[model samples]
Target: MTAPEPYAPAPQPAADDGPTSLVRAAIWVAIGALIAAALVCVVWVLIGGQNGIVGRAFLTILLLVGFAGATILDAHLAPRRPAWFALASMGVWIATLLIGAVMIWLPERYSWGGFSRFVQFLFIVLILQLVLLHVRLYLKAFQRYDTTFTRAVAIVTIILVVALAALLIVPLMLGEYLWFPDIYWRVTVAVAILAAVGTAIIPLVNVLFAPKKPRAAAPYPTPYAVAPVAPQLAAPSAPVADPASVAAPQELLPWPTYVDGATPLPMLPDGSPDWGAYYTGYPTPGAHVFGAPEPTAPQTDAAHPASSGYEGFPPPPPLPPRP
Candidate 1:
């Protein structure tokens, strides 16, 4: 039977926890601020008492509160939205105040000195808030994007370029206003021109040298391929010997497995008495002429002729007769 295929694990979705969400939130906030500013203006025109300092002060407070609220929300909750939020807040703050100032001036209802003083105070407050908020956001941006000296240097260069453009553009735009001195006009025009030029150059410079967005590293290189080794040839085996050609030892003497070692008694060489085996001196029957039996016992001394000295030494007294 064929084997079953192995199972694979499923992949998970990425988390939504970054700048894009904040940017979206900021856009909504800006839209809300625009609506609020329009509503306040409508309320002021319809309500008739809009001419009083009390009414203008209340409206100013209301709009400034909105700006502050949007700033705080953008800074704290949706920092990626800061640029757009800040822009919206500044636009609303500046446009509403400028329109209100012009209306007060044109009607010539409130004393010009009094209105001017109030407007100057209001502008100071607005400028302070804008500077503080922008400073905070800029610092945060710098900290997030720049750690190395090179990164900081790049950031400074971009800031200087933008500043130069502002210096040149603002003065020329306000050139015809007479109350402002020629010196002020010249400075503003110089700032606006320089800032504009710098803005143009910065983009090209950034495109050429800005750090590229980081991407995830590719998965590790594929494992190296190994070449298969050839199988080795085995040596030829030796031939088997025949079993029958080997000899077995006789049953008498003990067999010696090696030339130098002993074995069992049955395997030893035979040495029997009937085969004239040598031991001590003795004779057997001579089966020859005269057919004499070999000497059985002793022959007494012939020269002595039965001498008495041989009585006790008759020696073995003739051995006991054998059957």
Candidate 2:
């Protein structure tokens, strides 16, 4: 019987392929609009936002920008991202826009100065939060397409935007008074510009000072060891004198232990301390002889024959024969 073919999974579509040209063009258009809107806000701030209408105008413009950014973000990420992810981000965006708009409208309709001050602060906070969140999202999502130049530009732009937003703290403190001092405004602007320019050069610094990879050491050249010619040893020459001369003593060395060292020497039947059975003569060398004064030539003397040779002392007297 023929074997069955293995199962194969169906290929899922790519993220880029999921969006049509029209949708992509729309995304680009939205991106361009966001850029243009940012430029307009910068221009407005530069052109002396000291007018009495600054409160209403800036808030309105900012809220509209946030709404557009949030909407575009929903479209940009939804196709690629999971449903829950899209829903969560988009929901927060819309919520911020709605709350800000309602807050703005309530103060205007009621003409409450104290309430307006509160709403103004609330409004500033909301706008700043939305701006920071959206910028973070945009930058993070587009990292795959980032270049060195684009990254540097983004860093500089972020610094400028944050610095500009900081100027609002002064306006917020003034609260419905509509009085922004010229020196403070000029100082804030100059600082923002200088910071943006200075911060932008960090990418260049990274390029210049990046850590270098360490070099691999060359494998130390191993010289082939010259095997010594073993001196062509002359057959070791029969070890000079005789086989009897270098032969080990017939009694092998004793087994070693601490007790063995402390034990008294074994006595011979004749009551001498036996040095070893193989010892040649009584009083083996330094010992004085007993039967005969001199160590009588290691001879087989009938009565006291050369047998168990004591190391030093002469053997004690033999026991009397049994009756």
Top candidate on TM-score is: 1
TM-score, structure 1 vs. true = 0.28
For residues 60-157, write the lDDT of model 2, one tens digit per residue: 57777767867676786767865544544555454445445444433332346536656675767665665556456545533534567767666676
TM-score of each: 0.28, 0.26
Query: Distance (Å) between predicted and true CA of 247, model 1?
Result: 75
lDDT for each candidate structure: 0.43, 0.51
lDDT of 2: 0.51
Span of ten consecutive residues with least summed lDDT in model 2: 225-234
Which residue pairs in candidate 2 have backbone atoms (N, alpha carbon, C) closer than 3 angstroms, thus clashing?
Answer: none
Whole-model alpha-carbon lDDT for candidate 1: 0.43
Residue lDDT tens for model 1, 1-323: 96755665555788755545545565566567666655765565566454565755565566556556755564455444455555554444454444443343233333554455455546544544554455455454444434465355545545654454344333322322324667865766665565455334434545556577899998554222111211111244464485577564223322211111221111102211211211111223331111112333433556654343455663222221122
User: Which candidate comes out best when scored by lDDT?
Assistant: 2
- Candidate 2 at 63: error in angstroms? 7.8
